[model samples]
Target: MDFENFLKKLKEKDRVTLSKVITLVDNETKEGVEFLKKFYKERKDSFRIGITGPPGVGKSTLLNKLIERFAKKYDSVSVVAVDPSSPFTGGAILGDRLRMENIYKFDNVYMRSVASRGSLGGLSSSTENILQVLEIFGTDVIFVETVGVGQSELDVMEITDLVIVTLVPESGDSIQAMKAGIMEIGDIFVINKSDREDAYRVSEYVKSILQMKYQDKELTPPVINVSAKNDTNIDELVSRIENLKEIFIQKGIIERKREIRRKKEVREILRDMFIKSIDRELKIIENKNDKDVSPYEISEKILKNIDFKSLEDIWKER
Candidate 1:
């Protein structure tokens, strides 16, 4: 692909070109890395929100409502829905797009589905790269909907400006909601399907837990009850999101988060590059049919041959 032409077309707001560039980036092609290295500095400011929860929690329905509201309010809105990948084929059904088919009619709304590819974090490994590409494409708001997650899948908190944890009346008892991993990561707790009889009770229970957890902190995560199917209290939820975003901006929280994210991204990139450079050595070690050699001894041998000073200098130059 001619990256120069692609960039030009991207500036023209060509959705086709935008999709092509995203595919290139998502696949982590050499051209994609080059394109990012050339233009990542030009990324526009955008708010990233993560929606995550266990299965059958109405996350997609809630996200669809949020997108509709954001699309009307913002100049441009984008979504990345991470779906579970098939273990055998490594392909995803991409069903979130079908659930949110109505939003496609808006010219300002763009959505993409990505396979989680066995990432334990509930997000795709390329999620941050895709978000950056969308930022460069001029989005005002970006929403990332993660695959159905268990308790420890909290990686979304690292990359998003804020995380909304969606739940339903049938999710679990108050004891289940008090778990440390998923509960600790939420900036906002949403009870979808609020029309159900137990929805209010669940919301109140969550609020009490949050109050105790954040009593000393300046900001406490709010629990809101909304029925996505009935379109209940969605406007209020949107208002709360906007309000929290303002506070985050004013407190420089978003900037701090992005700085941390950038540092981690650099480390990850260096690790990946270093591993690829040692692929041949790793293969040679693997092919050795020695039954007596321990894995630790093999690793030590590999480490002995690597020049740390040279690698450090190379990294500094970059």
Candidate 2:
């Protein structure tokens, strides 16, 4: 479709349109990449929630229930399910693909599933692009569910307004949470599948971990318990998320989040531009090389000859 028509479609449609926009952004085409740069500058707000844990922590189930609540109250939601499981000759298993089918009927809930594909951070690098598209689409709430994340990917925090870690009882996750790593990133800790034997113990473990690791900050993350299958404590979980938003407002976290999002969009535009420039220049050099130029020889020339300062200046322009 033409750019104006596409823009109209994007502003009007649901998650499906957002999904298409992300796919276009991922393509790195001349028009596609340029459109995203403009689109990102135009779209500025989406309340992001990150639901992450190991594979079977009931995140999908909880998110399904959570979406039900959002649908009733909000205009729309954007969900990105990042499934990092090994491929069946390369395919997502039960994690993002099949699990999300539980909430597929909700018209207001727009879902996109992304195979993790050995992404090092337990999240795709292009996730920011997907999120920007959703923000432009006017989704009131955006949820990104990672199959898992390690200590390294604070990148998830870069885009999230709230980071909610979902855990089940007796999963050895308590110790994992306490190791001076994941605890700091959590805005909310959820003990899902609380019907299990050590559920309360897990809750206590989370509380203990928080008590041990908290800084002098007044807004400490809360440990919430919920059983998604039975729909127990679901309302409280919803309230807790709202509570986090209120806290965000009070603590100026909303502004902090906005600043981060602005920087992210700017960087993404520059990165995509550099990629295109590098690709095109290398191809031109290769076409000109009649003799057998070594790959390193051409690569070094490309690196040495390109005006990085000019590229940087281009990025700085509005």
Worst 10 residues of 2 by lDDT: 87-96
Provide TM-scores for the models: 0.92, 0.80
Q: What are the lDDT scores of the predictions, listed in order?
A: 0.82, 0.74
User: lDDT tens digits, residues 24-127, model 2?
Assistant: 75443456567776766667577899887666788888888888888888888878887664644555553454656546677888888776554554666667
Which pairs of residues clash in candidate 1, taking residues 3 or more apart in a chain or in different chains?
none
Clashing pairs in 2: 87-91
Model 2 TM-score, all chains together: 0.80
Clashes of each: 0, 1
RMSD of 1: 2.9
Candidate 1 C-alpha lDDT tens digits along 92-143: 7888876685477688999998887756536776778999989888899999
Model 2 gets an lDDT of 0.74
